[model samples]
Target: MSMFILVSGPFTDGRVWNEVVGRLRESGAEAHPVTLSSRPEADLETHIEDVVRLVDSLESPGELVLVGHDYAIHPVLGAADRRPERVGRIVHLDAGMPQDGDAALALVPDPSVHELLRAEGGPGPVPSPGPAQWQRWGSTEGLSVRQLELLSRLAAPQPPRTLTQPLRLAGTAASVPSSGILCTAGGMTVELVEALVRTGPPQFRKLADPRVGFFELATGHWPMVSCPDELAEVLLRAAAGEGRRLTVPEGESPFLGSFLFDTPERPRVRNGRLDLHMPKPDPGGAQGPRPAVLFVHGGPVPPHHEPAPRDSPLYLGYARYAASLGVVGAVVEHRLHGIADYAQSADDVAEAVELLRADPRVDARRIALWVFSGAGLLTADWIAAPPPWLRCLALSYPILAPLPGWGAVGSRFRPVDALRAGGGTLPPLVLTRAGLETPRIAATVEEFTAAAEETKALLEIIDVPHGCHGFEIHEPTDESREAVTRAVRTVLAHLEQPS
Candidate 1:
């Protein structure tokens, strides 16, 4: 019989694994459930310690199988590095694997995700959850009524610093076997899973090592809740070294196709300066000028082209998607961070809109802005004092206001207080946060809604509790991605309507 340690996501306590652990036990295996601290509170190192403590207390001399679902990948990987000899194998079940110095949750690829992490004061060591905090998250839908009650009685708040603690696994390799059990049913797209395996950074790249394997289950993000039997079977297979290669199905790539632009440049003056980018459609052409969408990249320091091909998610994926739908999409590069005020980024957006409006190929009537974290705030400022042609705004975890706590700006340039200082009227807005319940994120949205008022909708992807800011771009579960796509579509439709 093998000893199995199953870890759950950030908001969840060990109780999430009750059914799975029971199945493992019934099948003659010993299983332990590991819990992580909730967000905006716990950091990364504390998380690592929690897992280490659990493994050490087991007292089992034989190799242990470690399983991490979602956010638990950080701690599990860290623990394996610490006790490679005792651990037999590691499994990342739909979880993002972290690289050296990269926060675990930061592995999510969305720019809004990066911004959200940044807004939360940059990843650092987080605390383990104590009983009360675990109980709160237990009541979430995935757990059964009895399970919730049990967790409520047994749960605890994790420490606050576990999130930011860096897990040192650079030279240390996992001596035990590893596997990634990806969920395909619940918003987990084949595209994302394959991308994570193929192109994900160093931390995630570790999963592809020869000693590691892969498995795919047609389950949602919470497989233990939605399909315990299937999850159990997959786990058993991996434990027995019977897992197989998991491959994403081939198709006309939904996100990688290219579209041709008219090559005409839209140029306009705003705030006493001319701004320029690719132009939209003109009415006189065979088709009316198409509605326009502008994607603003994050960071004040990195030039738009500096992060070009990698940053091309904007140009290649999103902008192309919009263009395919008859929407004029343009990627805007804001001025470098230190040289210009962050507010100037917003001005640049306004200028881009003006340029789009002036272009003979552009339909100035319908314009939309999609901005991620750093750019999201800048876009918000521009919307606060919206230009005449700007029609709709879709902000993915936009930092409408400055974060309230310490250590929020990790490696990124901090925004000026003036960017979100005074109360100002904002345009129709769609606001999202990673962990909606976190005090800081929730408060930020509340403040944003108060400013934007009536013409706003707030969507918090519950499954993606922590890295909401930019996680969407990292290709979150299909449900989350659909929700975002829907939000963008709805906003675009609204912008196209008579105002």
Candidate 2:
């Protein structure tokens, strides 16, 4: 028999787990819901102590399973680390994986909330939003109106220190087996995680550990409120290690596929963060420096990924294909290691551009920048002020607007707002839209296109009706091939225009 300990996240307490605990009990399992210190000054340590003390007080003698939801995972992990011997299993329910010295604020997926917490001289305790604004925390899908009212009525402001204080760990708890409950409505799924793991990022690779199990809930982030019975059932299943297991296939990278067009060997030279692919000279003779297309691959990829994006098969293929067109193709590796490092990554892009211009083999007066995916944010700056040297700008399945709940952090990176703010004509812009893109992301692209129309920006749209996000590498159909070819040709045509 397993004794279950449930810890609720911020803006609520043990009461939030009432129905879930009841269901667990009805199933013949011993369950306890924890309520931490409500004092305004209570910090992370206080909450960790609360969980540790609860474990000490439990009189049950069987396996102990610690379950944490959202921000509560911090304390749960801390306590588990301190009492590793007693904890049989640890479950992370719709919460981030925070390492030692990480503050909960940094783990917040919402750019707006992250900025607020990072700013100085803010409110002491963060107030819970109204039920209508619950999406800011996580998706409210599947939550009934009565449940929303209950949540609003019982919500409490969270202590500031609970989010500010860094989580400290001795790493002992890492040895304990763990389970993860991913909420699809909250923007994560087993499929997405598996895809990321396939990208060969070092941090995501740890998820393939056999000791870890994963389960997905169709409900929103607050499983306790939206689907308590289901949550309880999953909790029991997690204790039994009966969830999906993530495995890494031993073969070529899944993110890598055969390029639409093949190219002959090209000269590859590395200059700091940029990989320059030099085109073969024409049969007549060698020409002067040629125009360059700098490919900025999109990602919040882990910093420790081996080979990096520049060396990845997809990016390498893009660069090589550019060279095949008789133009210098360049791939830049920037430090977009995590969501919070967008500003830094943008700076890296600027630096890479300057480096490309300084090279003698590249034409400094003509350059086209092509950005993809999350890297679309870096385009905000270039769009706001198109330099004379910038021939064209291309974006593929780019995020043009800030994601919901991505408040201030995404504000600076909104290309849609940037175009509106610039209120000036931009160079020819080519955008490739994915018909089957995720709704939230497609919304951003739609918002950007709408802004372009309003601002009368010079834009051409390419549609991949049957394509998903990253269709070039993932779709592999004739449509995907045609779209890529058209985009590359359009960009090259712009580069060839009078300068």
Candidate 3:
């Protein structure tokens, strides 16, 4: 089981997570809360070190969920970037998203500057809003007298230095999975959130990240104090990587004979969570080791352990077809696990490739990648540095540009930008463009194809006339069928090419 590390923002301590920790512990997860120095002199680095030290002491740093609320997000992110491999995911509670070069509080501009001075204490030390403030912030709808009293004691003032300190992310934290939980139940409004995301400060803007699962709760900013039970469940689901998982049911087989292969009974753990489906070897071992194809299914894959079926009809029939053609075919479940950041997703593909090469039934030196839809972005790394084993890449309606919605990490994920850096010549490449695709999608692919040619990338561009995106399976017309047929032939033919 993964462990949960609860981190409180300024003015509060570990006690903020008391209710949340209790519920998580009961759920059998190893939950603990870390307190940051609230001393007037406590700066950003002081808090960052505090969290990093706790993470370092963990038995399994990789099995961690670092939950940060409000101001604590900076230090939590600092620790994550410092030790990217140690932290698995970061959960932000009513906090703004920080970009690569943003300062802590720089992104969270208040709705009005007047509200800050409107409170008591003459703007001396950032006065607490008192009971009325708490009520407006969120509800104590179900909280007992003790909970409310405890909340009062938890409110205090910490140094403003933490916010003033500029946050410098080296793109490492982008590798760590992340999620955001917005408080709509309190004084916050959805329309206001949308406006903030649109207007300025990178913080609110990141909430719209397609990869970061967006959730709303009808509680105040202090949901831990107001609705710990409901808050705990959200964190639990986030920890479990519940994204907009879309599952496609197993499709009808169109192979000469029913697949002689067996579906693995259960998922396996490799670098991360993964499931490998392979074709059963021919009877009496007719076809020994053969060239392999790793099917990279696109996903916002379904929730944890729930129907992450990557084997669409196209993949199923293709896998069977590969087997009949005397080639080993493997379908991989590229469950994002909310690590939708391109860097980590690419790492996953790398790990899966290694697993494929290690299989005795696969011709390790002759492997190919077949990627479809959104997963096309992951091909950037492979394209930039084509492994000798990577004979060819068959990209269907591939996305070779930076998709801000996908929370792309950096310019390297942008193919055209990466191509400017100049690298090894890409191996034989076959790119199929769906004629009916949106103009933006079509333009990006066209741009990529043109750019690839300048780099002298051995490339083949195939246009499927009158074919829509995913037409290969969903709306398979004669044109679509021929296009799919060409894709299969392209990979095999590329394999036959002499080095």
lDDT of each: 0.57, 0.83, 0.65
lDDT of 1 by residue, 1-499 (tens): 7889998875568887888988888898898987665555656766777888988898775789999876688888888888887888889887754555555433322233334445655554233334333322222334456644554455454343454456668536446788878775433443444443432221233444567777877755667876788788889888887665544322212222221222222332222322223333445656656677776655433333334422344334555556555676666656624212455665665676677677665678777777665454565355435555566667665555433211223322222232244324444555555553334434555666554434343332223354443454444466556555666576677568775
The 10-residue segment with the lowest total lDDT in model 1: 250-259
RMSD of each: 11.9, 3.9, 16.2
Q: Rank the candidates by TM-score, best first.
A: 2, 3, 1
lDDT of each residue in 1-499, candidate 2, tens digit only: 7789999888899999999999999999999999988789999999999999999998877769999898999999999999998899999999877777767775665555665666787647777778787777778999988888889898888888898898999999888989999988867778766755654334666788998999999989899988999999999999998888988654324235545556566899998989899998878886789999999987767665765788776778888999998999999999887666788888889999999999988899889999988788888998888898999999988877655333325567878888999834578999999897767778788888999899888999999999766666553678888999999999999999987
TM-score, cand. 1 vs. native: 0.47
Supply candidate 3's per-residue lDDT for 238: 89
lDDT of 3 at 452: 79
lDDT (10s digit) by residue, model 3, range 1-499: 7688888755678988888899998998888798887776767889989999998888963478998887778888988989888787898887756655455543332322224433465333444445544443334455566766776777776565665567777878786767777776443444444433432122333455654565667865678877889888988888888643212222221111122233233222233333344455568877566687777765434234223434344556565565555566666666443323455667777888888888776678898898876577777787677778889888887667633222223445666756655667667888888786655456778888888778777788789878755555453456766776677788988876766
Candidate 1 vs candidate 2: the TM-score winner is 2
For every model shown, the clashing-pair count is 65, 4, 7
The clash tally of candidate 3 reads: 7
Error of 2 at 317 (Å): 2.1
